[model samples]
Target chain A: MLNLIANENMKIYRRMRTWILVILIVAIVLLTGILMKTHEAPPSSNWRTALQAQTTQLQQELTQVQGKHVFMPARATAGMEIQIKKNQYEISHNIAPAQYTAWSFTSTIEQRAIGVLLTVFVAIVAGDIVAGEFSSGTIKLLLTRPQTRARILLSKYVATLIFAVFMMAVTIVASLVIGGVLYGFANASQTYVYMDASGHVQQMGMIPYIFTNYAFNSVSMLMTVTIAFMISTIFRSSAIAIAISILSLFIGNTLVAVLSSYSWDKYILFANTDLSQYVFNGPLISGMTMTFSIIVLVVYFIVMNGLSWFLFKKRDVALT
Target chain B: MADQIAVQIRNLTKRVGNKTIVDGLSFDIPKGEVFGFLGPNGAGKTTTIRMMVGLISISEGQVLVQGIDVEKNFSQAMQHVGCIVENPELYKFLSGYQNLKHMARMSPGTMDARIDEVVKLVGLQNRIHDKVKTYSLGMRQRLGLAQALLHQPSVLILDEPTNGLDPAGIRELRDNLRRLAREEGMAVIVSSHLLSEMELMCDRIAVIAQGKLVSVQTLSDLMSGGERHVITSFEVGDKALALSILNRLFKDHVVDDDNHPHLISLKIDKERIPDAIQALVEGGVRVYGVSAVTKTLEETFLEMTGDGIIA
Candidate 1:
């Protein structure tokens, strides 16, 4: 079994596709960093001046209202006017400086870039792990050796996981290096996350945020890898497996959105895509929790992998 | 025959849909014998070999290799058997030495010395360092043989071992296989559509047709008992008169060609050739040349299979 694993690892490491995937991840992360660094918000001078003038006018009106209420309107129904003035004051004071600065922008960009990169890379690597042997007519030679079919398939699965982890590490390292160089490293350790519903944000210290982000990203990536590998084994054709996996990644979200509008959305695989959405939300989304997503994903993983193993074990290795 | 049987198949039948590829086929190959499996295209030779190597499942029968049931303990049974079904496939990116090294690690008790021995056995010493992709077809075939023999397997099953080799390469392969069987006591089962090659190399041959075993006999037994013929030539004036006289005297004993005169052939018993010659001479027909024609393996194969060469 160890020998079989070593053989599978050699095949993956020697393939040109593996290197191509690694290089593509680094290139994409670097490109994301460059785009973020050169991005500006059209100077924002006009919007700032307009906002200042509005604030001054609102403050002047509040002062006049206060003077009137203090002098003669004490007995006259002044409570309603005073409430209006208080609302105006609250609005003006809340308009402080914008929070979407370079630091916050880089963090959001890195988070999204890493997610997309890991998803795509893991899907591709895992999808071709077993299917490629069938495509290339090597499976016949491999099975004829003194090794069980289950061992052979398991070795391929383990090799794919190793490849996924390697690619994720590459993406993480590249993102951090490029991000720190372009944007100052002063707040490098801080966790800056954007809330999806209200656009509210939070800042946390570096260690806790980085560890949590890594854990979440790793789990998400593993889910995609396992799913793709199962599809590859069930189909035994690299082209079909890869096409279905990538299409699922893009279309699964839409299906979830459509299903969520109806009553049956909870059963779809896409509904669990946001496994970590609860962590960033000030409060978790109603009826959706970390435990729920984890259970749903674990079920999906088990079913896909189980079917793959069954089909692969029973497949007739007919190579013409 | 040796006390140990290298391979045993009993009532083995493989059916794919409506077509039965191997039906009720049973055979036993004794230890240290070079057995030849001969058949035309689509004659279930490859299917039978695959069943022996555990590449395909046996539908209704059992295959035992070296006393172990193939279906029950395939890996353990396969450990004693080495096979090359169809073209030998190797990793194209790796060098010849690297390819052998990888396969050597799978077999128990194999070391670098054994690798070097097989490499030299296949006569690939000069180019074993080159990538397999750069080798010629014949070279690849040789390298495949090296890999098969790396484990020093007791039973070696090879399908079309000399498919794409030149005449010299074929001869070398024949000699090497004979040596393995004779000197090392390795049981070998070789499959090929070339009957003449099998006749030269195998101690025994099994002929198959339409997924059925037609016959299994020694090479001499199949070729020795057939009818013999003798060719007799005559030169004479008035060819028509001579032919008439000869036919009248040796009726039902001669075959005359009108287009080619002075040439008559006789298919008589070997012992009766002298008597027929004396009788023909006394009847006043001039005998020019007389010789016996050797029977070839091709005629015997055609007579047995009722079909011509596939190509």
Candidate 2:
């Protein structure tokens, strides 16, 4: 199994596609730095002044909307209040939101759409994990080796998951380093502050919060990649796997939104994908809990993997 | 009860949908020799090979590679065998050396020395570091052979090994297979429509037509019909007189050549071409050409299969 996984890793690393993905991610990180730098107008060294200005602007906007009926949710008002309080506390303690802080970096990952980039790149590998062999006709050579079908398929799945973990690590490390280099590393040790759904301010260790962000974001990633892998083993064409996997990634979010109005939406794969909902986003469905979603996800993972292995093992790889 | 057989395919069969691709075929290949599978297009040669290599599932029966049942214990059976089905499929994105290295990882005991040996054997020394996408078809075929030989498998299976090879490449491969069989004593099974190449490469040949085994025999028996003679056809007028004269002269060797119904052809000694013409001429049959026919493996294959190469 280790040998097979090693072979798979070599195959993936030697391909231009993998390099392209790595380079693309690095380029995105660099581009984010440039855009952030150029977009920050009248750059201020003192974050206190910046925070005071932001608080005044938000408060002004809030007061103007008070006399007029607005469509904004009550949570938005609560979130704004928490943001103002957090900024005031930072200012009082002479704490500045350094341009390159790890907390800011986490926000960059979410705000600058790095998750989408990471997902697309990792999805490509997951989608191609099995089906690409058939499309390229190389599976014949692979299967002819002294390895069982289940072992080979397991190796591919492991390799893909390994790649996913590597990509996630790269994302966090790259963002923090690049954001630090471009702005200031002073905020690296600052705790991450955020507003939970209940309008409460939550604080956590910087490194732990970044890791938490990674873990939470990866819940959807893990599910999508598993789905992609399942599709890959079932279909011999890599194109179909890639197309459907990517399509479902975007479509899944919309589906969850459309279906969340229903009570049974909790049973859906997408509804369970955002595991961060337990601590961060809050559950989409009323009765859904972190453990409940975890169960749904585990069941899907097992069933999909079981299906892939069974089909791959029993398959008659006739021509392609 | 085991013999010195490298591969034993017992009552093998493959069926897809309503059609039986390979039907109840059985054959054994002895060690230290090259075995050939001769069939036209759509013949079950590739299907059988796929089954043997465990690329495709065996529909019925079993293939034993070095006495290990292929279906029941596939990894063990495959450990003794190395194969390439249809065209040599490889990771074109990787360099030849990397490709070989990757394959070596899968097959245990394929050390650097063994890789170098196979590389030299296939004559791919210089371009081994280049990506496979840059290789010509013949180069890829050689690389494929190098990969198969890396593990020192007891049996090597190739499907249409010389499909896109140049004349020199084909000759080079023939020499390599012969040397491997002689030096390493590995059993080689190759399937091809290239009858002449197969004849030059294999000691024994199995003919398959429409998924059924047609005949299996040594090269000499297949070509010369168990006699040390060449089959020759003489185009002549007075077909009845020529056929009768040839029948009487050559005895059991004389048969109506299905290839040319208008002329009578017979298996005769090459040196006796003049005697045949003289007999035909004296028998009042006008001989147009008294040429000694090339008793090519082509003739034997067509006769055995009873069908043309549709694909």
Candidate 3:
């Protein structure tokens, strides 16, 4: 099994396409950093004064909305309150109003670059892992090995997952190096501030924050890979698999938002894909918990993989 | 013992929707012999080979490789078998050596030494490091053969093994398959629609048409065992006299042919050719030429299958 996976890895990494993906990630990271650096809102030396002024304005707004009959949304009020609290906390702790650093830049890339571009790149890899073999007519050579069809499928799946992790690591390292070189490498132990699920502002280290974001984001990434893989197995065309997967990945959130009024929307895969909602903000739909979303994601994962295994094993390889 | 049999295909059948692709194919390939599966286009030759290698599912019956049932225990059965289904599709993005190494990893116990041995066996040592996309069809075929022989399987099966080879390449493949079967005691099964190639490569040939087995015979038996009739053509003088003389002496043996004026065609056994010639000479008919017509396998295949379905 290990050797099979190694074979898959060799096939993956030896191709110029895979290297091109890596280069794209690095280039995108550098371009984004260069763009950000050139945009120059020079670092404010009076950050404390700015924080105090922001806090005062937020307080005035809170007081005005407290007794007024003006129709303000409750969620908007809560968001303002959280922002004021985070500002006050930063001021009291003298955290200097989120200064630019290598750690922070890496964190930003994790949010912006890894969120969309990484998913698309990983989707391309996962999508092509199985269907590409069929398209090239090498599936005959692959399936006729002594290993069973199930084992071969498993190996490909595992190899795609390894590639996803490897790409994630590459993006992380690239973003950090570019970020550190452009912005200073100082503040390696910076603190990040955010609101918890209990409506209180909290602080965490920069490294942990990035990793926690990745951990939470990986739930959605996992689903994307599996969905692409399932489509890859079902169809013999890599373009179809990749296009549908990317389309769904971008459309999933919009789909959830469009249907958020429906009570059953909580059961949708996109709604549960963002497990961080349960950890920090809350579920997309009210009354959905972390356990429920985990269960939903697990079921989707199992069903997708089950269908892949069934189709891969039972369907005849009649490619002419 | 049952170990002498390399592959036992018993009542193997394949059905797609309402149509049968390969029906009730049963044959045992013994060790140290080259077996041929010959058929016309759309004759289920590829489908049958696919089923034997577990590429396609067997609808009704089973295939056993070295006495192990394929459908029951596919991996174990496949361990004893190595096959190339159709045109040897390799990883074109990878070098030929990398392709072989990739395949060698799948079949456990295939060492680097074994890979090198098979590379040398297929005579691909010089170009083995080049990418397959740069290879000609014949080179790819050799690499495909090398991949199949890497693990030293007891049974080696190739479908349309001579599809894209030049004459020399085809001859080399034939010699390699023959030597592998003879020296290593491996059972080599090759399928082709090219009858003459099969004639030179296979020890026994199984002919099928439209999913039905037509005949299975040894090469010699298929060529000369059953029929002794040779159509003898005689170029003679005095067409009327020669025809009359031939008809009088060999009444039922003479063919009513009018393609030539002085030529007489007779379907006669070999032993009676001298008597007919002497009788014609004594009857004052000059015999200029006497030649026996031979039937090629193409003619025999068309006769057996009875149509224009050959590729």
Candidate 4:
């Protein structure tokens, strides 16, 4: 089984396309860093006075909106109140609004790159791993071996997952290096502030925040990769598999939002993909808990992989 | 004797939609023999080969490789088998050596030394390190064969192995396949529409047409028309007189030879050649030469398949 996985990895890494994806990630990170550097706001040394002035201005806005009849006035006032409390917390704790440091840049890159680019890249690789063999007519060579079909499919699945992890690592390492070089690397111990699920201000170290973000994003990445793999195994055309996976990736969140009014919408895949919402913000739909989403995700994971294994192990491979 | 049978296919059938592609075909390929599958296009030769190697699903019946059921115990059955479905479509982006290595890893117990040996066996040592996209069709064919032979399987099955090879490449493949069967005692099953190539390479040939088995005979028996009469042509100086004499002796046995005035042909038994020659000589017809023209595999195949298109 290990030998088969090595073969799968060889097939993936030996191609120039796989390496191009890594290089593309690094290049995009560098470009993003350069752009962020040029547009960065200058650091304020008098941040304490600035925080007090912002609190006073927010208080004025809060009073003006208090008696007004507007759409979502309560929600607007709640957001303003959270901002005032955060400013007060920073002033009392002597934690200035974060400056543009290497850790901050890494955090920023993680937010943008992991959500959009990394998922799409991993989806492309997973989508092609099985379908590529069929389209190229190499499936015959691959299947006419001593290994069972189940083992072969499992090897491919494991290899694709390893590839996703490797790509995420590359994204992280590249962003850190670029962010460190462009911005100063002095704020490794900085704290990130956010409103927790209970609407209370919470603070954590910068490094732990980045890791938490990755851990949350990885859940979605796992689902996306499995979807791509299932599609790849079921369909013989790599183009169709890749296009469908990417299409679903871009539209999953939108689909959840469009259907969020229905009670059953919470059971959808996208609703459960972003587990971080349970930790930082509230869930998309009311009554959704961390346990519920995890259950939904596990069910989806099993069904998708089960269908893949059933179809792959039984379907006849015709001449392509 | 039963132990010598490398592959036993019984009632092997394939049906797609409402049509049957292969209908209850049964055959046994023993060890140390080069077996040929002869059929026209869409005649189920490729389908049968695919079923034998467990590439396509078997609709009915079963394929047994060295006593292992192919569909039931696929991995064990496949361990004794190596096959190329059609064109040896390999990874064009990978070097020939890398492609071989990829296959060797899937098939356990195949060492690096075995890979090198198969490379040298296929005469691809010089270009083995080059990417397959740079190889010609013939070289890719050899690499495909090397990949199949890497495991040293006792049963080697190839579907149209000579699809895109030059004359020299075809001869080289034929010689190598024959040598593998002879020296290593492997059962090499080859399928092709080229009757001449099959005649030269196969020890026994199984002919099929329109999903039905037409005939299965040894190469010599198939060529000689098995117990049937042969077309014997006699070159004579006096064609009209020779025809008249041959007609008077055996009217139904004489064949028309008007196309060539110097030739008189007969479809006759081998034992009566002396009687015809004596009658021709006594009737003042000078016979220059006499020759028995045995039927080639082409004629025999055409007769069996009712002149189906070879392609």
Candidate 5:
């Protein structure tokens, strides 16, 4: 069995797509960072200049509505003037400031970019783990070995996991290095997360936040890998399996969002995608719990692996 | 026979969907002998070999290798058997040496010295370090053989081992397999559609057709199944008169050709060749020469299969 695992690792390493996926992920992350660095006026950034510009626009709208500077009479208005000025100040303050520098800008980009790249990397690695063997006609040689079919499939699964870990490590390390160089590492230790419902934002230490983010990304990556593996085993075609897996990753969240308006959203695989949303946001959407989402994902993982093993063991590999 | 039997299949059958691929095929290969499996295309040779190697499941009946049931203890039974079915698919990206080294690791007892010996045995020492994709077809076949022999199994099953080799390569493979069987006490079962090759290499042969075993016998037994007749050709003058005299003397023994008057062939037993020669000489026809034409293995195979041996 150890020999089989080693052979599986060798096969995975030799495939061109595995390296291509890794390089693609690293390239995308670095390119996005460079683009963000060069493009100083990116619309996503928050700067004081843009904020003041927006504040002026809101004041102009108010002037247009009343046809003049609407100031209350100081003596006869009975404190109405003070209340009106307070409301105006509140509206002006609410307009977002655009004091966007490297620290704030790179953080948001890194988070979203890493999440998307990690998801894609997981799907690519897991989707082709078994299907490529079928396409290359190597599955017959593998099955003819003196080991059981289940053992062979399990070894492949383990190898896929190893590849997933390697890819994630590469992506994370690349992001941190490029992010530090471009956006000076001063605010790197600050946790910038938005709070939901209460209209507030909380700041945590950077190391703990980054660790939490890594853990969350790992869960999502596992979901992608396991799901793609199951589909690959069942379909036995790399393109089809990969297409279906990625399409689900993109569309599944939308489905959960639309379905959550009704009562049946909890059962969908997409509902589990935003595992960090509740913790980062406020209360769960429609009173969902973290434990419930974890359970749902765990069940999905078990079912996918079980089905993969069953079908792979029973498949007749006559084509290979 | 009990001590000699290396692999035994009794009433073995396999079916894919509704079509029966192997139907009630039975054969016993003895120890230290080269057994040839001969059949036309799609004659269930691959299916039978797959079943023997525990690659495919047997629908009915069982396969016994060295007195162990293959289905019951496939891993243990397979430990004593090595096989290459169809095109010996190996990892193209891996070097020849790496491929064999990996296979050697499967059997824990095998050593690096054994791998070296097999690599040299296959005459691939010079190019064993090169990737398999860069090797020629003959070289790939030799590398596959080296891998199969890495564990030194007692029984080796090769399906169409010499399918695409040149004449010299084929001869080399035949000599090597013969030497292995003779020297190492290994039972080798090789399947091929080439009758002449099998005739030269196999000690015993089992011919299959349409998923059925047609005959199983020693090479000599199969060769001597029909009447042994010697065809003697003679170059003579006045072939009609010479033929009439020869036909009258040896009734039902002469075959005359109208195309050439100076040539005629007479089919007779070896013992009667002298008598026919004396009578032909007395007929007053000038005889130039006479020589006996022996039957080739091709003719025997054609007679057995009821089809032309070479298409």
Candidate 6:
């Protein structure tokens, strides 16, 4: 099993494109850091003052939310209150706000936006891993080996996931290191302040929150990779697999938001992709909890991969 | 499952949709011999090879590689076999060495030294480190042969292995295959539409047409063994006089073919050659030259297939 996966890894890394993608990722992160530094926001001489200002801002937003009563005002009201209380707690504890710190680079909602870009990179690898072989006519060489189809495909799957995990880690670590170099490293050891799903303020050490936030964001990334890989195996066309994966990534959230009025929206595969939404932004619909989303994601994950494996093993590899 | 047999096909069949592409073909390839699948275009040679390697699903029957049924346990059966179906499909982005290394890793317990040895055996050591895309067609075919030999399989199956090779490359591949059969005791099955190449490369040939096996026999048997008194045509001066003298002496064996009256032809054995020539000369028909029309395998193949559309 190890040899199988190692063989795949060798094939993957030997491509110049994989390294180009990696380098592009690090370059993007560094460019973002440099731009943020050059156009530096107002320096927070004292985090206490920043926290007080943020708390006041959330209060005003909460009043406006109540006045308008639009766009799920209840959830919006709960979300504003949670953010305000968390800001107040940070202000009381004397933990200064620093968005550019290594920990904050991972934990901050704005910084977590980079995860989508990382998802595209990982999905590209997943999309190409299987379909690229077919396109290059190497699938004949691959399948005729001594291993069974199941073992061969399983190894490809494991290798793709490892690549996904590796890319995700690169995103996190690169951002963290860039953020630390541009800002300061001391904030990495600070406390992690956040709002839980129940509109309550919570606090944890920065290290734990840093890991959890990255891990939490990866649920959606893995979902996209699984879909991309499934398409790769079935269609044997890298272009179709990569295009559909990227299209779904950007359009999926909007479609869910547009179709939120429907009762069946909760069951849609895209609706359950962002598990972090349950804890970070609250559920898209009432009564949908993290555990419910977890169960849904697991089913879709298993079913998609089940179809991939079944088709990969049984389908005839014609002389394409 | 005989110890000497490396591969066995029993009633193997394939059907795509409503068309039966290959129907109930069976053959055995012995160890230490090069077996040839001789057929015309679209004769199902590739389809049968695909079924042996489990690339295409078999519609009926089975292929046994080293006594293991391919359909029942594909990996175990494939463990004893290595094959190249159609063109040698390789990862163009990878170096030739990396490609062979990848193939070597697929089979468990493959020695590291095996890759080096095969590289040398295929005469690819000089260019093995270059990317496959940079290599010429002949080099790629050599690399393909190298990878197929990496695991030291009991059976090697190559479909049209000489497709893109030059004359010299074809000769080199023929020499290597013969060496593999003789030195390593490996069973080899090579399919080709080139009858001359088959005659030079294979010890036995299986002729097929329209998805059905026509005949499978030793090369010599199929070529010249079964028939006695081969038709030998003589181009001589005054073929009419030569024909009369030879006809009177050997009767029925000698005749002046109406197609070319200047030449006399006869169906005579090796012992009767001197008598036929002496009769022609003593009759004042000066025999300028004596030659036998050695019927080529191409003629036999065309006769068996009933068509000349061989690829």
Candidate 4, Cα interface RMSD: 0.9
> What is the descending TM-score order?
3, 4, 6, 2, 5, 1
Which whole-number lDDT from 0 to 100 does residue A241 have in model 1?
77
Q: Model 6, B135-240: lDDT tens per residue?
A: 9998988888888888888899999999989999899999999999999999999999899999999999999988889999999988884777777778887876
Tell me which residue pairs clash in candidate 4.
none
For model 2, state the Cα shift of residue B194 in Å: 2.4
lDDT of 6 at B217: 93
In order, the first chain's TM-score in every candidate is 0.74, 0.87, 0.90, 0.89, 0.76, 0.85
Summarize candidate 1's per-residue lDDT along B1-311 as a digit string, tens digits.
43578988888888878879888888898878899998888888888888887777788888888888988998899888877877777888778998887787666577999999999899999999998889998898899899889988899999888888889888988998999999988999999989879988999988887788888888887776345544455555445666676676667877776677566666566777677667667766567766765555666766777674432
Model 3 residue runs over 4 Å out of place are A44-48, A63-74, A85-99, B237-240, B260-262, B308-311
Interface RMSD per candidate = 1.7, 1.0, 0.8, 0.9, 2.2, 1.2
lDDT of 4 by residue, A37-136 (tens): 7886765889899999999998888777765633444545667777897787678756567546688788888897555789888888888989998888
Best by DockQ: 3
True-structure RMSD for candidate 1? 7.4
Error of 2 at A313 (Å): 1.0
Chain B TM-score for each model? 0.89, 0.81, 0.94, 0.96, 0.91, 0.91
- Evaluated at residue A84, the lDDT of candidate 3 is 85
**Per-model TM values vs. the true structure:** 0.82, 0.87, 0.94, 0.93, 0.83, 0.87
Tens-place lDDT per residue, model 3, A1-320, is 99999999999999999999999999989999998888857758898898889889988887888879456766677788778877876676555654567898999998876667888998998899899999888899888887888999999989988988898899889988998899778767667766666555567888998899888877788899899888988887799999999999889999999998888888889888988876676566778888898999999999999999999999999846
What are the clashing pairs of model 6?
none
**For all the predictions, what are the DockQ values?**
0.44, 0.75, 0.82, 0.81, 0.37, 0.72
For model 3 chain A, give the 10-residue run with minimal summed lDDT: A193-202
Fnat by candidate, in order: 0.38, 0.97, 0.83, 0.84, 0.31, 0.84
Question: For candidate 5, what is the DockQ?
Answer: 0.37
Candidate 6 TM-score for chain A: 0.85
Cand. 1 TM to true fold: 0.82
Residue-level lDDT of model 5, residues B1-311, one tens digit each, is: 69789999988998889988888998899888999999887788888887887767888999999999998887778788877777666788888988887777666578999999999899999999999899998898888888778888899999888978899889988998999899999999999988889999999999887787888989988876666787888888778778888888778878886688598888888888778767778878778888877666667666666673332
- Candidate 5 Cα outliers beyond 4 Å, as residue runs: A15-17, A41-111, A196-203, A254-266, A277-289, B226-235, B250-253, B257-263, B289-294, B308-311
Candidate 2 vs 4: which has more TM-score: 4
**Can you write out model 5's per-residue Cα lDDT over A50-140, one digit (the tens) per residue?**
5455556655655554574565332323223333343343344442233233444444544877676677767876888789878866676
